[model samples]
Target chain A: MIGRFLAGLKEDKRIWGQRVAGQGVVVPPVGYSETDGSAGGDWVEVKPTGVVTAVARVHRPIPHLHPCAEPFAFVLVKLDGADTALAHVVRDHLEQLRIGSRVEAVWAPDAERHGSIRDIACFRVIS
Target chain B: MSTSGPPKEPVKYVEKQLHLPYCYVAGDYKVRYLAALKDKTILGSKCSRTGKVFVPPIVASPESFAPCDELIPVADRGVVTTFCIVNIPVIGRSIELPYVAASVALDGADISIYALIQECAPADVRMGMRVEAVWKPDGERQGSHEDIIHFRPTGEPDAPLASFMHRL
Candidate 1:
């Protein structure tokens, strides 16, 4: 029920960075210079297109015990403008995927409501 | 015709105030620091090039950025460089209210470290009072910051102003 209400992003968007109070910078700024501390950093828009970096088939139920009757796959996607990769579920069968299968962002209908990483439905294998 | 009684629904409530214990794995440098703390001894690393000593033993010098592996033992007695009084209480803090947290520069160490001072009243604490580490008993030693317990006034005569001027 959690994922049902809180599903994927409708559009590709940028997530801003903020500094933790009283802590110095540990990670290097990705899109901006160190001197521009006041401005924080600039934003670089990127498309949702990315190749599946890795995939895993999960047969066991999650800790929350939501019934996932059939086998599901988890895919790690390296989006543009981000240093790290985003991990989410994929709906395709295990046999359908190659090492570098192309995947695109799929959004749920807006009428269903709300925002978050869940707004984008699971990545489907692109034909 | 309904013959069965009303069905019961499952109830749920949130439990508050969960406490979790955490253990930290100290590296070689940190290990030495903690070991010294058990004896109420303060140790620091000296920068070979700048000859500056950093309390809590930094792996590298801030100024030269050179690797400092030599462990230097500093005298327990030192002067307070700067400090603040903690009027408000924080979770997991052992000390009570009106405690002084000061940056103490142990003798022979160039840089100061933040530590708590005990065995004195808040009004008696000063900017340049000499303080020394108070160690826990040998049996209670645990090789961590808790080993030192807290710092207290040394009650010794203060060194001349010229002695610590250039070092600062």
Candidate 2:
């Protein structure tokens, strides 16, 4: 399921989720429902837009460790159509980031994408 | 079952390389110890109150809770207090499998330091086995643990258990 999800990001610039028996939809599908242990049953596409549910600010970025050198916030984003939130980073507008803040995914350039989680370079605060 | 979508290739593996680089400030005691290693000399910090010694020297002694004020020179040859034969291969390390890693209590030290025992079969390594440091050639010395390639048996009779067992 994750392979197909990553392939969708690489090939179509899309995000994929899975619909489990009990869970509504899980982004970056794990092939099963984490809550009820039921196998995921359907391929679902979630929107790139999301809401910031959690945020942690990094002030002093360690060299080669943090994704960015400038101050940024690591956030949990609940993308539209996904029941659970995905942990990701917000590189800009960190001061405006808060619970319920609107955000959208920023894709890496086509030439730089390699079918990995990092294919979505980062998220930007929209509101 | 739900309707299947277009066939997609399964990803068996995802190769990702993560690099984490950082600097560590080796304080006064450790800096001096590594410097001595380059000269084929081993220095252990001696606790000012209890006279206990620790290699890879620390400022404070764990036993006496007192400052270790003196860096005493110790012989590289020592007795193995205990050891284990490593059978599994480790990534990045070039050492062959089934080698013995032991804690060697260098003469005149209260604690044991870890060292690899080589130049002999794994079965031949034993507690109390006598071993000596095999230093890399002078120019190749880097003042790190790697300066001493590995410890090898000295053919001397194993130290009596009663003499070194307490240091384990």
Candidate 3:
């Protein structure tokens, strides 16, 4: 399931989720429903845009450890069609990032993309 | 309608590296212990009631359950009470394979310290072996355990097993 999901990001610049028996849809599918332990049913493409459900602002960044050197916020974003949220980092406009804030993923350039979570460079506050 | 065949090729592996950087504050006793290392000195705290000494000095002795307030300097040479010949290489260490890792009871210290034994073939490393520390260049010392690269044979006879048997 993870392999298929990574292929989507690397080859198609797309985000995919899976539908489980009890859950509507989960981004970055883990092959099973976390709520009821049921196997995921089908691959579902989710929108790149999402709303910030949670935020953690980091002021003192540890060198070579944190994603960005300057201040940033780690956030949980619920994509348009995904019932669960994806944890990612937001590097810009951290002051504007809060619950219900609109955001969108910023994909890595085609030449620089690899099959990894980092393929999505980061998320940005939309409005 | 029947489902289409599976996708032609699937990703087999996705490589990732995790890096976490952090700082640690060594407590008072450890800070003093590490500071002494730069001068090629080994320090241990002694229990007043039992006179037992422990390296990497602790606040209290487990044996006597008393506070160890006296810091004592122990000899650089000691007896290997127990040891293992390591054949597997560790990821971050550059030591050659088939080296000896041992518990050495430094003179005056009741507790044995974990150290690497080198400068001799693995087959020659044995229980009760007498060894001495091989220190790094004075200028290169960083007040860490690495100040003593490893313990090597001291050309002395093996200590009697009876002398350090309790430490095994």
User: Candidates' DockQ values?
Assistant: 0.02, 0.24, 0.30
* Global lDDT of each candidate: 0.63, 0.87, 0.87
Q: Which structure among the candidates has the greatest DockQ?
A: 3
Q: How many backbone clashes does candidate 2 have?
A: 0
**Where is model 3 more than 4 Å wrong at Cα?**
A48-78, A87-106, A121-127, B1-10, B38-40, B86-99, B116-125, B134-142, B149-157
Candidate 2: residue A96 Cα off by (Å): 17
The alpha-carbon deviation from the true structure for residue A89 of candidate 1, after best TM-score superposition, in angstroms, is 5.0
- Per-residue C-alpha lDDT of model 1 across residues A26-91, encoded as one tens digit per residue: 111222334443432322333466677888878764643322446677888655433445677676
lDDT (Cα, tens digit) per residue for candidate 3, span B41-160: 999998988888888798898888999999989998899999998999899988889899999999888889999999899999999999999999979999999899999999899899
RMSD versus native structure for model 3: 4.3
Reference-based TM-score of each model: 0.54, 0.62, 0.74
Instruction: In candidate 2, list every pair of residues with a backbone clash.
Output: none
Local lDDT at A8 for model 3: 75
Residue A52 lDDT in candidate 1: 76
RMSD of each: 13.9, 6.0, 4.3
